[model samples]
Target: MSAAEFDWNLATVWETIAEELPDAPAQIQGERTFTWADFERRANGVARTLLDGRASRDDRVTQYLRNSPEYLEVSHAAFKIGIPAINSNYRYRDEELRYLWEDADVTAVVFHGSFTATVGALRDRVPRVRQWIHVDDGTQPCPEWAIPYEQAAAASAERVRAPWGRGGDDLFLLYTGGTTGMPKGVMWRAADMLRQVNDVSTVHYALEDGAEGIRRDLRGPGQAHISGSPYMHGTGYFGATMAMHGGGCVVSLTAPGFDAAELLDSIDRYRVASLAISGEVFAKRIVDALAAEPGRWDSSTIRNVLTSGGMLGEQSKRALLEHWPAAAILDGFSSSEGFGMGWSLATKDSIPETGRFAPGPNVWVLDEHEQPVEPGSGVIGKLVVRNRLPMGYYKDPDKTARTFREINGVRTSVPGDHGIIHPDGTIQLMGRDSLCITSGGEKIFTEEVEGVILDHEAVTDVLVVGVPDPQWGQSVAAVVSVEPGAAPTAAELIGHVKARLAGYKAPKHVVFVESVPRSPNGKADYPAARALAEAQRQPVA
Candidate 1:
């Protein structure tokens, strides 16, 4: 195929793979497996269903489900028919769900049966959603208003190539877990996303060689890559995408939450070649399970243990290597807006200290003046990716301007992360500058939690901060002051926050004080609050 005959859209690439490797397994969940041909046919059926539901090109389709084969199938169908698939955090409450769908202008939603009640309650509120596709998980039957996913997947077996055709400009909107206040959708074009992954990630496609390149690389059934992370997040979705791009099977855990023992068993059962996990949160559990039950699972098939979203400290890496000695632990330093910023590879032979990373080819540490920071100068600067960046935050041009900038004549994505470049060209990652607390790979904004805590009648004032934790990189801590006569226990306040927001955003450590530290003008003294929380934080029992 010539350059004119092919576009850089992922749909085309995926279709090419399907045509080339029809017998290869594409998706696996426990006892269920779908080959490339099966995958293609199901996606085509779903695509026809979406079209029948009047989903237009570039229309937003939301996936409000957990990790399952149906999630990827719906997403593939959307991509095939030129619809942008949007991710919805299943942990979200009613308000969050409403805000995301309304903000995204979602036209269609493919959700699991478990979320039937939530979706039913808010269905009328999100009037823009014209189509509701439901996947049965034995929790509930298909609602009258929603189309059953399996029925939709069997609508037609023929392939679906949209009339608008595929283009590089087709989008995939990834909503960032609200760092400031409300979640914002980051718009990623198909070409940029494909280019970054193909060049930097495990999947390699020679653009000049077109479909032939994909055929050449995917000679047989590719490696089995499994991830316990939710497909709603970037890490898990990208890991699965990379595997599919290489003609491999995307294996997902059926458990609703992360299960270390189950993951181990699945890896051994499927002969999984690569495992994707979040940092210390998952590593600690996996390491402990293996330590407790020695020689219980055959983990020799694992060659790569890929992780991102949080700090996988030196301790966890070393502990993990003890079990999978031959496995290479690839710690990816990335974000939703900018991928391949920096990465660190650790093996039994070589393990670098925590926070030290080799920057990507297009990554640069820019100073306050928007110039490159001098290496070995010990100056911390914002980490920037100069190429293959997302379009910007959808419908939020202000944030788009703030994050994605044209610096020194090149478009760069500055996602508020700070780091220092060493003389050896390695980066010392210093975390984000936005005061966002990343506990167990979840970004929790202090203000969001503080607002919820203050809603309690007994609470007079509250200041939330992040304190160091051995397990999570940083744990959310709340310093609160009760009313003059009211006495609310820490558990009460923590529960209050959990009821309002996701459990991960709730404060892990709650300290009651006489007053919250603030300036004369009532501005929060963040440093002082952090200090107080750190001083009073109790040891995890």
Candidate 2:
């Protein structure tokens, strides 16, 4: 590709790679493998389906399914047809699901059969959703109104031509549940997002001057990558897209949820070159699995282990190096809003601190007064991107104003994290401030968890707090004031939470009391709650 004909959009770039390397392996999900040819054809089939709907440019399509080839295909399909795709958290219950779909103004949904009841229930609520594309995973029968994924995909294998082509101005929405209440969509334009997060994320690719240069750089023995995290999230989606952008193969986990044994089996079978994961949650589990039965699976093909989207502590990093001695472990710092804030590389020779990263040219730290914080000041401040960043929160003017602020006339995305800038120009992260706890790299908003726990029949009042743990950076502890004579055991209450919110967000420990401590004005005294929970963890002495 020459300068006059260069195209940088994801769909175009991917089609070019397929044209150049048609026989190469592109996608792997459990027993299924898609060659570049197969992937391109299926993606085109999806594009043709959307074209039949006459989907105008910039329309929104939401994916309400777990990680699968269909998920990626729909994203690729939407990209080619000049529409944006949104990722919905599969763990969300009925009302939460309704909020996201309605708020996004979703035009279509490509959902799983398991969610038939959920989406079927929301059909009358969201007026904009005109099409329902259903993929049958056998959890339930497809809703009668939905177009079967098989039939919609019966179009020709060749790519379709459209009057409106995908361009750098096109959108990619990454919806994040910021520490507090509902999820917010961070909008990133295609061209900038590619170069910023997707291009530099892969280990196999080096710095290239332009999009064409990167394309030429990709024409080698492309790396094969697998992510232990769910593909819907950044740790999985962005990492896999990085590999895919470099003409590499992306092997996905086929299990319904995070299964250590299944991920290990897939890695060994595919000879995955790069493995991506989150913080302590995944790290401890993987290390323990390897330790339980040494030499049970081959991890020799893995050369790079990347951790991001959460803090991967030094203890977990050390354990990983002990098992995979030959791999390079890297800890990256950034949020769903933007990238290039900070990074740390850990090998056998060097191990980085738990929440520290080497800050570079593009990222900056700012004090409460919106001024740049000098290194070694010991002052905690919000992490902001000084250079290229996202446009703003989608359709959220008020939040956009709050987060993406103008500092000295330049716009930056403040990801709502308070941290320290060390004398050596390293960043020491203290995590987000929304009463949100990060266990194993997944953000657990306290308010949402408390809302679910309060709905239980036996409970009276609850305050969810984070406590220190060797595994999982912090475990959720619920301090509850139960009704008189109500015998709700810890296990039973935990089970109740799992049924409501995602299982990981459930409190690991539940402490019952006659009354929960609260301030006079009815505000939660988090410090008091933390102390009470910490006291509960101590052995009788």
Candidate 3:
């Protein structure tokens, strides 16, 4: 099938899936399972309600629901109306939410009733928000200004098709995790985003027979996915969207929090074939649970175990391979602002020492002067990307231009990550450029340091940060979580890392801690870590 022949609009894709497999499960959350037909009907109903309330085609609707049937319905509803929906991370505080609400000019909001007080605090801050619809999961009282989600959606006419232009319409505005000052909104066009799935199936999956291959292998009867990440992040959102587009089911684990037992049970019960998770934490937990109760659950249905949003350590990778010998453990690297840059495909041979990620079209590592570096040069540079990238940060042109540059007179979006292009053409991600530390005029990436320290026997988790120094501009510091009851000295841990890396790259000071703070998406909370290091330092007399 040619690119022109494929319907790039998300609504059109949903419609096609509905036509092909109307009775197949589109989403399974707790006791509620929504089929393709049901998904379409509910979305259409929600669209009718939004339109009747005078929402414009390009208006923004914000969704604050958890991982449930309503989140999927509202996402589709906004798509049907040509309105860009913003999926709010449930962990956002009032200050963060206010910035996002105002930044996106959100016209309406659909949130869980439990967060009514949180939303109420920001009512006056977001002047443009016209409607507040609440979904109650029996946790808290509904706010006074909020209307029931079901009632509002049911009050409108049924499934009246709206004729909104499809191709170039901005479908969603996802907020970036603000490791910096404030989170920025990424504007995603429908056609450009959906085209990414084509690459996933054809290039990454390497479907031999093109469309036929997709039909037989990816979307065949009983094909399903289980997502452990929240829908607000790119990993979960893309996983669910891809499953629906492929005419497959999305099995939602009903666990309130991340529980290895619940995840394993959900996969076995639903017979999920494809599973996507944030990182090695969930995989390690699953491995530990399985070890405790050997062969208690039937996991033969799982084929692909996709890991993204964070790194999968060697220990967890080995554990996964040991437990699920038949499953292919795939590691993907990308961010909410960027498309999928690389992925490690399933292989029959032994796992290589280096993680393999297939590079996306027009993605490469560039030196300080923005020139592409040769593989195996032992030089690390910023990772730059082109082709179907986001427009820029919403309402922040200064930052948008600084990070997303026009290299060689061609517009490109670089998410400020540093990496080295291996000799074999695979990209080795070296963490974000903003997190890079400069000490004694030498640039050292924090992820490289953290990776080396994590290999130590006493270390459970580690975060490397740059601290202020009198001589050097910044000094390397390590914040670590050691094995319980094993209080390894700071000097001992530093020596371990120094043995693997240059003395300058090694941490000058090490602080043992219970845990390293992480973002919702599993990336290191560098800002918090830096603050902790700064506070712990003794003042110069």
Candidate 2 lDDT, 356-448, residue by residue in tens: 788757777888787889999977677787667888888999988988888878887877766778899898765566676889997676655
**Runs off by more than 4 Å, candidate 2:** 1-7, 203-215, 436-541
TM-scores for the candidates? 0.82, 0.79, 0.91
The global C-alpha lDDT for each of the candidates, from Candidate 1 onward, is: 0.81, 0.75, 0.74
Score residue 220 of candidate 1 by CA lDDT: 72
Stretches of model 1 off by over 4 angstroms after superposition: 1-6, 436-541
On lDDT, the leading prediction is 1
lDDT string, candidate 1, 1-541, tens digits: 6543446577777889889889888998878999988888899988888886465675788999899988888888888877688999887899999999999989889999999999999999998898999999889999999999988899998888777776777887888773346788999887777776677557677765777777777657788989777778777888888888788898878888888899999889889888778665577678778988998999888898888865566767887888889899998988888888888999998988666799999898988897889999977688899867888999999989999999899999988888778899999776566787889987665544664665576765677889988899999999887756898877777778778567888888888888777532133567888999999886323
lDDT of 3 by residue, 1-541 (tens): 4554443356765665575677888888778888888888878777776775465675788888777778878888877767788978788899889888888888889998778889988898898888888888788767778878877667544555566644445566778774666777887776567677656631232223334444344443347787787787777777776666677788776655677788888888888888878774566567778998998888888888778876666666766777777888778877766787777765445564333466777687889888889888978878777867887777888978886788988778788788777789887666677888899999888877787777676666777899988899999988887656888887787788779778898887776667777775565678888887777743222
lDDT of 1: 0.81
Every candidate's CA RMSD: 10.2, 10.0, 3.5
Ten-residue segment with the worst summed lDDT in candidate 1? Answer: 516-525
lDDT of 2 at 324: 76
